[model samples]
Every structure is written in C-alpha cells, then in structure tokens.
Target: MSEAVDPGVAATSEPKEEKPCVQCLVPEIMTAWNSARGACEFVPDEKGREECRKELEEIAKDVKSIKKGSEVIYKAIKSSSNPAAFIQAQIEFAKTHNAANTEAILKWADEMEKAGKEIPEDIAKIVKFYRIQAGSQI
Candidate 1:
C-alpha cells in the first residue's frame, strides 16, 4: 500500500442508493390510491385510484422545490405589518355581503308572499318594518 486515504476525501467505490421521496413516505396518499384500485384486490374505483397514483407521482418529482419556494412566500406574508388592517377589511367585507344578503331575503320574501306563502322570521321582520312605516298594527 502506498498510503492510507481519508474516507471523507476519497471517492466511494460503492454506489449510493437514492433516498425515497417524502411524498412516497406519506402513508395516507399511498393507501388511498392502493385501496381505490379494484383490479389489485385493494378496493373499488380503479380509475379514481389511477388518477390519484398519477397525481402523487407528479407531486413527488417536484415537491421539494415546490415546498421551499412556497415557504418563502408564506413567511413574507406572515411577517407583514398591517395584518390587522387586512383582518378589518375582511370583517367589513362580510358586513357588506350580509347587507346584500339581507336585502335579497327581503325581496324574495315579498315575491313569496305574492305567491301566497307565509313569511318566515326574516321576511316577517321586513314586513314588520313596512307595517311600522304604514302606521298599521299586525
């Protein structure tokens, strides 16, 4: 022997085995696809099973890169200021939507009353408003 080589510095003569993908290690997806396939005696809905299998295969190929890029974007949003302003805007949005929804309920109740159906509570509330407007007792 000429000299002993450092194992860390040396190129390995043996071939390294590639690690299985994280996506493949997820049991739920694999089980869902396996059980969904009828021809394999796993379950029924073989076509659906095949689709899930294809989807998982595609995801496995890109998941590591996809996850890394998404985490960057997510972290940026999570650390943002004015998060409360965003939340307030969302609340006001729900209020505006509720106003429109109430208006539609009133209109629908009017139509239904014209068609001879009894007014429900929400519709009755609108009718009560009109009665107060007309100075008439229910």
Candidate 2:
C-alpha cells in the first residue's frame, strides 16, 4: 500500500515556472556585494582577502548576466568601498556595449563630491570626457 503524500509536499516536488524580476534581484545582488566587501575588510591575511575577492568576482559575474544588469553594476560602482573593481566592470561593459550614460557618470561625480568622497583624478577625467561627449551629442 502507498502512503498518502501531503499536498504541500507534492507541490514542493514540482518545479514552478517563474520569471525573474529585475527590481527584486538588484537589491539582493547589491546586498551580497556589500556583505562580501565588508567581510573583505575584516580579513587580515592576504589569503583571506583573496577569498573575499573571489566571492566578489563571482557576484560581479552574476551582475553581468541579469536583466538591467547595467543598472546593478552602475549602482555597485557608486556604493562600492573599492570602486576600482566596479569601474573595471563598467569599462568592460562599455567595451562590449559601446555605450555609457553620460548623465549618469556626471551625476555620479556630483554625488561623490556632495558625499565628501574624493573623486580620483582618472575618474574626474572620465567624467570630463563624458561631459564633452554629451555636449557633442547635441
């Protein structure tokens, strides 16, 4: 004789079709990135740092494949404690996509200044370049 299975258990056995939501994913990815960054800081050894960096790289890979992935990467750049990584991601993105939002770059520069975060000279140059590019669009 077969034992009765609970409806909830039967439901769990079947895979449900679900579409991914960008809004839901972006926050989760950012949170994971932030947590990994925080974990990196507490790591005193180089090996520990390397591990943390690997985890961050994995998350970065995930960012590139999602819908509205550009938005996620851009926000990550803005909020990153180590913006260099995200900047590299953005550069790679631009290389393939041949697109970068000038308004967003300028706004990021402005926001960084307003927040008392010093804009690296290289980044300043990039912002300037984008500004000129934006003007040329007119």
Candidate 3:
C-alpha cells in the first residue's frame, strides 16, 4: 500500500496563487531605503557596504525617473485621444510622490519653458503652485 501523505504537504498540489504582500510601491520602496541605510551604517565589510550605497543610489535614480515619467504623462494627457486612464494613473502617482517630488517636476517645466515649449496650462499651474509651496527650496 502507498504511504498516505497530507494534501497540504503534497508536492504535486497546484501552486497557490500569490497575492499582493505590499499594498503599494511607495511603502515597499521606503522599506528598501531603510534596509539600504541599515546596510550602509551597520554592515562590517567595506566592499559590501559600498555595494549597498551603489544600490541605494540606483534606487534614487529609479525614483527620479518615475517622477519624471508621471510629470510627462500628466502633462501629455491634454493631447491624448482617451485621457481618463492616464489622468487616473497620474493622480495615483501624485498620491505616492507627495511634496518631495515637486522640485524635479518644476525643474522639468523650467527646461520646457526655456526651450520655447508651451507649458500646458494645467501643468504650468500645478508646477507654479508647487513652486510657491516650496518657496526658498525652488
């Protein structure tokens, strides 16, 4: 007779579907930053710590890219044939980015202005509001 095995422990059982363990990317990224900071401050090996610092810098660059992408997408909505989805995505991105992302978005607007490109009124006004909110930081 074949040995009985529990169904829960069966290797042949279909794989359980994975669900979101992290609610959003923002919190997950923050966790990554905290982990990187810990590694930078507490890791004993110099090479490993340096690697962590590089990894942290790469994460920062990715965040900058995401900010720029959201800014461009939000501004580009004016020209889109179907803008509803893009607008919603932009709103979601803004919710995650908060005030800290304003400087970069404003800087992008400045370059567009300098290049003789018209800043879309909606984007222009948002950047202007942020610039005011940022005050001396801008």
Candidate 4:
C-alpha cells in the first residue's frame, strides 16, 4: 500500500541544483591568474615559460567567460606587475562603476599617495570635486 504523503510536501527523486557563487568565482579566478602570471615571470627556461604562458592564456579565457564589459578591468588587475598599477586599475574601475562611492575613491587616492604613486591629474580633480561636494552635504 502507498503511504499517505503530506499535501505540503512533494516527493522527488532528483537532487536540488546548486547555483555558482559569482562573487567567490571572481576572486578564485583572479588568484589563479595572478599565480600563473608570477610563474610566467620567474620561470627560468623557455619551456617552463611557455607552459606558464599557456596556463595564463587559459585563465584569460575564463575571465572572458565570467562577465562582459568588466573583463578588461580584471585583466588589468591580474596582469599588473606592481601595486601601483593594480591600484590604478581599482581606481579606474571605481570611477566607471562606483562613481558615487566617494569614500572608496578617497580611500584609493590616499593609498596611492601612501604608495608614492602619482594620481592622474584628472583623477585628482575628480577626488577634489567629490570632496567639495561631500563637504557641502554636511
């Protein structure tokens, strides 16, 4: 005899599908690509260098598939050889996507200053404008 089933529950043999966490995937890809980039830089032999390059290329393809319009920023950050360049990419991304996030822009500007990297004149002007606007809001 069949058992009585609760009306609120449905019996199913299929397992629930899990969705990918995009936020987690972005950092994982970035870390992997950055590690491959370093390996490419320090590999002594031509063969090793070629292998690392291949790995980096694969990671680049993954980056492309992750999202549109933002892959350039990811590549810039991943391929940057120095902190200054990385921070520059961050600032540019903030300007493009988080223009209203004045606190973040200011924080990056401060970090650039601390790092002794010259902030671009246009970016400096933007920071100044934002600072003035923020002051007026108080």
Best-performing candidate as measured by TM-score: 4
**Candidate achieving higher TM-score, 1 or 3:** 1
- Candidate 4: C-alpha RMSD to true structure equals 12.7
**7-107 per-residue lDDT for model 1 (tens digits):** 77755578778765667555644433223221122213455335434543554455444334333323322332433432343355455655676667657
Candidate 4, poorest ten consecutive residues by summed lDDT: 68-77
Query: lDDT for every model?
Result: 0.48, 0.62, 0.55, 0.61
> Relative to the unseen true structure, what is the C-alpha lDDT of residue 57 in candidate 1, on a scale of 0 to 100?
51
How big is the positional error of residue 25 in model 2, measured in Å on the Cα after superposition?
Answer: 1.6
Winner of 1 and 3 under lDDT: 3
Name the lDDT of candidate 1. 0.48
Error of 2 at 95 (Å): 39
User: In model 3, where do residues sit more than 4 Å from their true spots?
Assistant: 1-96, 136-138
> Against the true structure, whose lDDT is highest?
2
Each prediction's TM-score versus the true structure: 0.32, 0.32, 0.29, 0.35
When 2 and 3 are scored with TM-score, the better candidate is 2
Residue 104 of model 1, lDDT score? 75
Q: What lDDT does candidate 1 reach at residue 79?
A: 34
Check candidate 2 and list the clashing pairs. Answer: none
Better TM-score candidate (3, 4): 4
Candidate 4 lDDT (Cα, 0 to 1): 0.61
Error of 1 at 12 (Å): 54
TM-score of 1: 0.32
